[model samples]
Target: MALRTFLLLLLLLAAALLITQAQGIGSSASDCCLKHSQKAIPSGVVTSYRLQGPESGCLLDAVVFTTKRNRKICASPTDGTIQKLMQHLDKKAKNDKNKKKGQTQRPRGRAKKQRRQQV
Candidate 1:
């Protein structure tokens, strides 16, 4: 009976620890964008973007565009210009990925060829 009681207490302790960790994770994320920008940003400067919403731990819905210089700019999700930019970025990313996949073999340098000939 004593061993059974000890085992029950251990289980309860484990349950409590799991609950605490789960709650900690809920508030661990930092808010990215405070508000959306009204000014139009050029698609040429934007490299990529990510959608931010309340579900992602943010207060407002936004399109967070990352520029070529590594700057994050927030824009309204409903904006038509922003949507076009997102589509452009998506296509550019797909093309870039395809180009990388096509390059299967790399040409060896002259130094490497000379080393093999000497051996």
Candidate 2:
């Protein structure tokens, strides 16, 4: 009876771990857009955004924008203006990430000294 109980518990734990891992596998690409919004987000007020493709299970390709008011808005990805803005934001994000990587690769004290010397 003790051995049977232990085996059952082990099986349950294995199943749980497998389910958890499977859920995480494609979670980062999952749909995150809300179904409703109280008001429209103004043009050029997006602070950040992410593009979600059909593979992410959204009904359509979506541009999930984070507005200056900190509200999230979902817009049609087919819009040309949205597409351009998404591309611009993507480039800006990449540049910012590269700058951070470069900064981190240098020692802080050395960076400060170099900046002081240049000035």
lDDT of 1 by residue, 1-119 (tens): 99999999999999998997777555624656888888889888888899888787778788899988999999998988888889888999999999898788675566544445564
Cα lDDT of all candidates, in order?
0.84, 0.73
lDDT of 2 by residue, 1-119 (tens): 99999999999999998998778665654546654343555557877987676566555567789888887788877777677778877887899999988986746564433445554
- Report clashes for each candidate as comma-separated counts: 0, 0
| Residue 15 accuracy (lDDT) in model 2 | 97
**RMSD of model 1, in Å?**
6.8
Worst 10 residues of 1 by lDDT: 110-119
Error of 2 at 26 (Å): 11
Model 1 TM-score on a 0 to 1 scale: 0.63
